[model samples]
Target: MTEEKYAGKNKPALSQSGVRWLWLAALVFLADIGIKFLVLDRIGYGWGNRIEILPFFNLLHVHNYGAAFSFLGDQAGWQRWFFTGIAVAVSLMLVFWMSKLPAREKWNNSAYALIIGGAIGNLFDRLVHGFVVDYLDFFWGSYHWPAFNLADSAICIGAVMIILDGFRSKPE
Candidate 1:
């Protein structure tokens, strides 16, 4: 048992490669928040009304009071705390995972960072406003896609990166 403990302690922490990936996660988080403030806030929520960019896309503004698809939006009022707790927990786990990655696995670190950043962004909103502000509408004809914000987009992108990384060869 003592030998096993000593072995664990001797293991090197995240190498330079791993730190770089973690930085990428931080960058993604900053970018997500920056875009929201520069574009969404400047334009003002619900101010654009509707600007059609294509047959299936439009820029609109909307605030979300609940989870995806506004889930639990109408609930008594516990969801705000519930979602907030979950996001915080997830963010912590992602960061912890990023720190443990091998030095050569930059892509994996980046993916984890993206996820952490996005989750934190939304978590910020939940903590401050009791809801997240969402504004990005995509649709075709009468069908309407759920409105989402920069944080949501980042999370999705990160998820894709993670999936892609899984197919790549791991460092020896």
Candidate 2:
């Protein structure tokens, strides 16, 4: 909680100028989809088809029918709509949240924008392809991290920023 004096600056004021952040969000979203398009067009879907860039890094094509880490990926297919709905709702909430931030709060705006963009990108895939396209792959010896894409990266960064924003907004 913030003290009264500090709370004023942190309050959600519903400013109209917050729309500017939407541009960044759109850019992020478009870029994510664009990369997916390139991957799908250029790379074969075979499991063994991947480009190794380093000892632990690769660009591979994958599809996630579930949420993060392929959780619920084995369900009877309801997860497509389920996760899509969640992403849609979260994206809307983030936009509203952005609209309430102070117009000059660039960091907070950027954070919200990134989350919204990532959400929209994944949601689009769920609706159109019934799965989210993933390409980036990392591994260590026999353990491999789940494949992911830019949207996932953006969402993670945004989530961290939001957490940082919380600490920064605390009363001094």
Candidate 3:
């Protein structure tokens, strides 16, 4: 297929670019950071300091030195910069994609904006704090899921939206 056919016929003008959706991304970033600071101020850090909100939920403050689910959290500390780099790169790439997309492509534009916001939110934490602050916790009986923050939640939701968009039927 030709490039135009594959990319679609939007040919958005400078003002019609999906970059308009950037406000959504900014909102996500602001909300994420705001909640994070609130958690830091109100909750003591670590599992032992958690405040149970419900049988299945709690508010706890903690730090993740690595990527999602603390992928390399046990590392000596290199993971901080590594994850930061990845977040920066991904946010830039998504913004570029958004710029090329049509303003009317709300679904994809929103997804891109969400991811960018989440990435930048976490990026801000990494740059200033040297770690990502996680506060929300969920548990069931003897099993507990990894703690995460608003930034992580936004990223996951955005990613799921993108995956679902892929399964949507196209007009052809």
Candidate 4:
């Protein structure tokens, strides 16, 4: 039994290629920051300063000082630093996890990369502007969804990928 345990101990892994995915994360970050900059340059900031795109869509500039859907946006102001610290910690953990992931697990790594990129993007906003820039808007009738940007979309997509990966991991 002891010999059996040691027999395969030195065997190498099937794949160790998560490092390549970091580029994907970087791309996400660049895209997010770039679009945000474009929005800032074009639309600037204000409520009545929006341009109508579709009947239900408008390119508006709104700053979110809190988490998703402006969770603590109305807080006394400590939430900004709190969310920034959380993002940093989460991003570091994701990078570490991505590094340790097997290269064969592309979906897993992609999810991690997207999440890391999104986290960094928002963290940058928190550090520089003290809030996140949201532009995209959707509405039906008088009801409206909270505005969001590319980073937020990427994060949501990545979360969906995580759920799909979980579904695919079950034994066949």
TM-score of each: 0.79, 0.88, 0.94, 0.86
Instruction: Quantify all predictions' global Cα lDDT against the true fold.
Output: 0.72, 0.85, 0.89, 0.81
Q: How close is candidate 3 to the true structure, as a TM-score?
A: 0.94
Tell me how far the alpha carbon of residue 30 in candidate 1 is from the true structure, in angstroms, after superposition: 2.5
Weakest lDDT window of 10 consecutive positions for candidate 2: 1-10
Rank candidates by TM-score, best first: 3, 2, 4, 1
The true-versus-predicted C-alpha distance at residue 129 of model 2, in Å, is 0.6
Candidate 4 residue-wise lDDT at 157: 87
* Model 1 stretches with alpha carbons more than 4 Å out: 1-11, 14-19, 38-48, 164-172
> Model 2, 91: alpha-carbon shift in Å?
1.0
Best by lDDT: 3
For every model shown, the clashing-pair count is 1, 0, 0, 0
Tens digits of per-residue lDDT for model 1, 24-52: 65676677667666555555567357667
Position 119, candidate 1: lDDT:
85
Q: Which 10 successive residues of model 3 have the least lDDT summed? A: 1-10
- The residue-by-residue lDDT of candidate 2 on 16-42, one tens digit each, is 446568888899899999999999999
lDDT of prediction 3: 0.89
Model 2 clash count equals 0
Better of 1 and 2 by lDDT: 2
Relative to the unseen true structure, what is the C-alpha lDDT of residue 35 in candidate 1, on a scale of 0 to 100? 63
